[model samples]
Target: MNTSSEPGDSLEKQAGISLREARQTQLLKVFLVMSVIYTLYLAKTLFIPLVFSAFVALLLSPLVALGRKIYIPRTISAFVLIGLLIAPFSFLGVELVKPAERWMETLPKISAQITEQINEISEKFEQEQNQAEIQAEAERKQKEAEEASFFDNWFKDDEPEAKVEEVKEVKENVVTGQIKQGSIEIFLSLLASAPFLIAQMFGSVILILFLLIFGPVLFKIFIQDFPVVVDKERTVQLVGQIQKRLSNYIITISMINGLLGIATATAFYFLGVEDAILWGALVGMLNFVPYLGGLISCTILLMVGVVQYGLVSAAFLPPAVFLGINILESQFITPAVLGQSFRLNPLIIILWLAVMGWLWGVIGVLLAVPILVCIKIILEHLDVLPHWVKLLESEG
Candidate 1:
């Protein structure tokens, strides 16, 4: 009786079992990750403010620490810092209203100019098409004439007097009443949401203040209570590294953007563009979102250009100059200032932007890079995922 299996068979059995276990483990991890992503997307409204507060807290942590060192109360420092941060933005918002209203008033004129430009382009295209059709018809007729037999030519009727068809132009009728009603409805809806939006903003500011004051204390408590199985010292180091990197990244990027905004505003003013400050501020804020931000800034500039210059070749100068400035800032200034350590893989950044933008819209897009950097840092510290961290590094 050969009850004992051969050594080769046992080894093969063990290898098969191990392979299946590996696959199962991988599948479970993928499932869990997807579940987490779905949960985040569903709970975005609840989480976005909290995440924003955390980031603000991280940004202000250094100031809070300095205050503590100087014997200032944490609460006082948080309040003062938050006030300083909010004041300029509020002032800028107030300054933007007049320019915004002026632009709104010019919308109808701009629309007319755009329509005329489209009509001109369409007419040029139509003329080219008509010439091509005429030439083709002539060629076909010449070929038929060459191929004609004497009897066939004699039997054909005099080409039916070369009948010309008249084309009737169709004009679309727009109902002004319907448009007005729709605009009123949209305005009412936005008005209804205004209070909610204000309340959310106020809540976020309060949350940020509280987080700034208490975040470090909470972090310390967590470190103390962490399971003995984990290396407490390493955990503390990891936390410190994340805070330092995030703070530096946010502060450096903000300063760069502010400089860019100032340059843009100065350029626009010299170019005689209206609402130069508003456009410049918009460019700075949107530039925080990477690819999409530049696109939006360029589009808005182009629209304003066309409105200002009436579709002339000169209408392109404003956006073109802004684009050049953006190229320089993104390619040269940012890398030089931030250094290689802050650079990230463009492909991964784009994918992360898409995912986050899908999940949380503009807010998601704004936070995408910071979140990606945090993930990269965590993975770098994990013994099992060094490759992932490497993949996230800039190729250059």
Candidate 2:
């Protein structure tokens, strides 16, 4: 034992730990750098016109190139594409406003319906809690209702009136506390911001239009002199792949979203819902977001349905419809079309929506996934990035 190389073993262990610690430190440094870069990108977004221009340019670049192939002038091709894209939305808004305004008046009733459905869910939960306490009582007779998990723990359909009443009393406060949507100040604030909001609206549209026109030319100029590579060939290749991938993504998403809108509109029409067209259009537009967008569409529809139907029984329609649509989209369309395309995990996508929704509101949520995908794509192609770095950026 005295002759054992104890000191050598200790040294080896120490060395290994030191190496691991150093590697960890290096990783932390890298994380810090990446965070700073993303922060810069977020800051740069206030100048969103430039970003919009880039995406538009990428989307139209292929078409513009095709135009050149057939001897069409690049400038003319850009203008034609912009007109084709912008004209539809412009027409839709003009026609849609009258119907949309008529529907807006139902907002209060819709909100009340949503509150009622929530109350039902809360009662069901309270009954379950009451059943659990009965089960825990030592003197209570062994009953069938006493056994179950949390879902069971909180939702026993059968419970004594006394027990149910007790549970109801406790949960009344808890349930009421959860019903926080808006205060007077929040509504007032929104009303106050209406002018600035209107200006931002026009600014965003004008920004989008400008991007559509000169986006490609700007892209060419931006990449013409890259700091990373000296050879023009590699640089051109990089730019081409980026444009192609982005354009392909956009075109595919647009087609899918359009179909979704049509499908949703058709379903709502059959359901005898009011303003079905507007709701469907909303669903279709939001459908671009994958899992999270679908949820929002479902929530809005549920609220409207609950408001219209005005009963616990009627409230079930929204979730039922939601489940069916999700089943079809997830089991079929997503796997077949958008599977490898998004590659990002559903949870991450949800989180991205939530974060963006918080920072930039609805527009933020709308743009989050696309922006994230773009960032992932760019990071993926960066040669200097490590495997782990690439892995994080990769679609799931």
The estimated TM-scores of all candidates read 0.83, 0.68
Provide C-alpha RMSD values for all models, in order. Answer: 5.4, 10.2
- Highest lDDT: which candidate? 1
Q: What is the C-alpha lDDT of each candidate?
A: 0.81, 0.68
Model 1 segments beyond 4 Å from truth? Answer: 4-13, 101-109, 127-196, 381-384
- Global lDDT for candidate 2? 0.68
Across residues 29-138, which tens digit of lDDT does each residue of candidate 2 receive? 99998896577457744645446555666677677778888999866877788778779988877877887655554444444445566767877886687667766753
Writing each residue's lDDT as its tens digit, candidate 1 over 201-281 gives: 888999999888888898888788857627888888877888898889889999988888889999999989988999999
Clash count for each candidate, listed in order shown: 0, 4
For residue 90, give model 1's deviation from the true position in Å. 0.5
C-alpha lDDT (0 to 100) for residue 225 of candidate 1: 87
